[model samples]
Target chain A: MISSLKIVEAAENSGIDQNIILKFILNEWVVPLNKKELTLDEEDIERIKLIRELGEEFGVNDEAIPIILHLIDQLNHLHLSFKNNYCH
Target chain B: MKNPYKILGVKETASLDEIKKAYRTLAKKHHPDLNPSNKTNEAKFKEISHAYDQIGTNEARTKFDQGEPGEENSKQQWSSFYNTQQNAGRYANSYADQFGDDEFFENLFHGAHQKRRAQNQDINYLMDLTLEEAVLGVEKVITLANGKNLKVKIPPGITSGTKLRFAGHGLTENSGPPGNAYIMINVLPKAGYIVQGHDIETELPISFMEALLGAEIEVPTLYGSVNLQIPPNVSTGSKLRIKGKGIITNTDVGSQIVKIKVVLPKKSDPELLKAIKSWNGKYDYNPRGEK
Candidate 1:
């Protein structure tokens, strides 16, 4: 029952340009669920927002973005696993 | 709410370039993404960013110098930015075009800006539903942050984690169409039924006598009760499928799966004990095939 948004909808919702979202996909910063359809989930939208915040607000350059995204993904994965282990 | 110039450690007369340099220097040191393990850096980074946003451009600096503070200052900055973007042909269907003759701009300067908020982000509301409410459709009224009551019709057989989108019902923005509201459904755990996709699974407790001899037992369903025939020699964990009695969704109608649980008599009967003792190993059966 996970809801998905098309690429255009994702761009509109995240307030990022479609071209930037395309660039994010090209750079593999955000992976779409369906490559052909360019369908994105809520996670992808949040990632796009994070990328925009990092680039626009924090002035982080393009090169450093992927590194930060990877680190964030790792942290999220660890946090989820930790929650599963302790909370349940 | 501290002085923007003082927060960035720049003089009031500092140029935009000098302010930008100061912001970059402080931002690099305090950026939360760069210093993810540090908590205070996040707040410091926000302070720096806020200071920069307050006085980053000439227009914003001018507004700041005029002693306009808080959200009013930011709204004017955004309004001015929108005007600039509109004049540059960036926003084709921008806010200016939408409210061209509505006196919105006049209202902006007249301090009536609180009537509208610039929201371009979709809001997610977590909706909790009981198993019965989910299986059977129900209409619910939810109060949003704007104090607007939205009546949402819960569709039948809606599963957990399903998102119901309300288009154009989100926060009204200053420019483009309002964002959407997504209702995320989370079904609470029910006592008797376990939801598996569209199907419902529940245990039917029957006496050992009923298991030994065939009997018609009444089983509870989401909609109503159904009489199920328990065949002779039914074992524990055996599932009986009642077709089209589970959940009815738009796509499909599911079946209710009844798991058999045979319960023994709490008190032993003298006649039964004597009969069992008389036939101890003579009619013994190995259920596990251990023999």
Candidate 2:
């Protein structure tokens, strides 16, 4: 688990604004595992990295983030289902 | 305006579940987060979203099928409603009053950045690895486009298409922080080995005498060569499994499967041929089961 300060550091290292990460959390784009301490896991880090990529690389705006995130989640679910059914 | 059913890649008479499934599949494929944004994918995403909005629910589908004015008008009217609902808590004034025009509102919702900050561009680096390196892991020193060298530690058991990210290793901005670097792993194919999940499959060639006499021979694995006992009369294309000799992951260990291939000698001695002729007359064995 990583703290919010560590997330901020990671955001800074990745050229993302700390405030933007906080705003994403506030907007429910990236929810922390522990709401009070704001602890994050590896999955949350990956999600934040993706969010940063979408925003900085793809120029996706805040309004479309939720939609894109939901689509990505659905895609992952579909991929997992297929893998479970066929590959396993 | 495109047809909703065509945009979602479903028939007009498709059920609600079919429509939803199609929409989810297409939306996942063309989602901007997963893919790099281009004109075609962006347009396709918009079309899909619009189609879903038009016919996502049973009521909406029925109205759309009926070609009613109420549904069409309601679709156009929802833009302002969405803007107002999305921006209600953030903005003091209504979106219409603040933006003053549809063009600006659309830009604000889609592309316009509220607070402009100088950000370095993220870099994607392609890294190729051999099958052995991928299974055992390796350390690689890569030189970036900017002439800087970075040493990367690749974890063991990494599959192809895995990505490793290095924070703050990309281009540096004058005002803001540096960007990140991503290493995309590509595993090259190896001869005589097929990777299936964590397990590995390889063909083990054996002489016809060895196959008939059940000889213990050394077979190659990822770790090293190990001795395997072949049963007598082992046929070609027989599979032999060596447990715990495959690619190792965090949770489970895999097996190495060896496919047996029986090889006959190119030239047969006259004495051996004569012996075989005598043996054939003695057994009267018909492998084909011909009467």
What TM-score do all the candidates reach, one by one?
0.45, 0.46
Q: What is the lDDT of residue B196 in candidate 1?
A: 85
TM-score of chain A of each: 0.89, 0.78
lDDT of candidate 2 over B1-291, digit per residue (tens): 246888788988888999999999999998767766332355457658878988999888888888763445444433322232232212212223433344553564588665767778879999999998887667899998778999987655667887677778888856667788989999999999999987999998899888989999999887789999999988899999998777754334578999999998899889989999999999978858965
Q: What is the DockQ of candidate 2?
A: 0.04
Q: Model 1's lDDT to the true fold? A: 0.71
DockQ per candidate, 2 decimals: 0.03, 0.04
- Which tens-of-lDDT digit does each residue in A1-88 have in candidate 2? 2223355554543334454455456556666666787755444544665665565445775446767876655444433334444466
Candidate 1 Cα errors over 4 Å, as ranges:
A1-88, B1-119, B173-175
lDDT of 1 by residue, A1-88 (tens): 1257787766554445565576577656677767788988655665665666566545775546766765654444433334444467
- Writing each residue's lDDT as its tens digit, candidate 1 over B80-181 gives 323322222222222234444235435644766554555567889999999888877678999976789999977666678877778787877558568888
Per-model C-alpha RMSD: 22.1, 17.5
Worst 10 contiguous positions by lDDT, candidate 2 chain B: B85-94
TM accuracy, model 2: 0.46
The chain B TM-scores of all candidates, as shown, are: 0.56, 0.57
